[model samples]
Target: MDDLARLVATEDVRRVMARYVYSADHHRWDDLAALFLPDAPFIASTVDGSVQARMTGRDDIAGQLKARNHPDSVLVHHLFSSEIDFESEDSATGVWAMEDIVTRPAGEPAGMHGYGHYRVRFTRLDGRWLIAELRITRLRLDWTY
Candidate 1:
């Protein structure tokens, strides 16, 4: 790809990643459906085997995530130091260093603080960038009760 084209694709992929974290943090589960391809898969696991899951299809991805998260919990995700590589005009791959804190309101159960990396694949379809596959692996995950 040309320099300008690569630049634009990079920015577009960044936007998609931003939207993903924003949607997840805000519990806007439905909005996340639009950020990924219909048949894409979402996978997450921890280094110590605390968690492991896989879901496919946009609707299933959103539905399963909504089910897993507590309604009263607050989630904040910080993504830093992303390395994105363009494989073609329509495809790219990225790894983002990430941290997240999940807490609940008063009287709620415990929460967790996590450090992770998101390895993702991106595809451009219909003039829009979307997450084609995402695999999240946590290097450190701490739970409080």
Candidate 2:
């Protein structure tokens, strides 16, 4: 890819990542699922290396996220320092520093705040960039009771 093309692709990938965070925090499950490929794989794990969940396909991803971030929950995700590397005209990989705060309803546990990084693979499908693979690794977590 040309310099300009590569730059544009990088920016597009960044936008996709931003959209993913926005949709997830806002409980926009359908929009969140649309940010990924139909058969994409998603894995989330804790800092200590325990697997939180593993999901394949957009439908499953959306369902799982909905279950985790329910109606009585409030989530906020902040992404920073994203580095995107283009491997080809249609493919790239990126890592992002992230922090998230989640709060449940009054009767539930107080809340959770976590810091992490997201490693992802992006694919340009049908002229649009989409997440093909994603794994979130936590660096730290704090809970309030």
Q: Evaluated with TM-score, which candidate comes out highest?
A: 2
Task: Please provide, for model 2 over 26-132, each residue's C-alpha lDDT reduced to its tens digit, 9 standing for 90 to 100.
Answer: 89998999898999999989889899799999999999988776587889999999988999999999999999999888777568898999999999998999999
Worst 10 residues of 1 by lDDT: 44-53
TM-score of each: 0.93, 0.95
Please give the lDDT score for candidate 1.
0.90
- Model 2 global lDDT (CA atoms, 0 to 1): 0.91
Writing each residue's lDDT as its tens digit, candidate 1 over 61-108 gives 989989878888889999999999999999999999999898877676
TM-score of 2: 0.95
lDDT of each: 0.90, 0.91
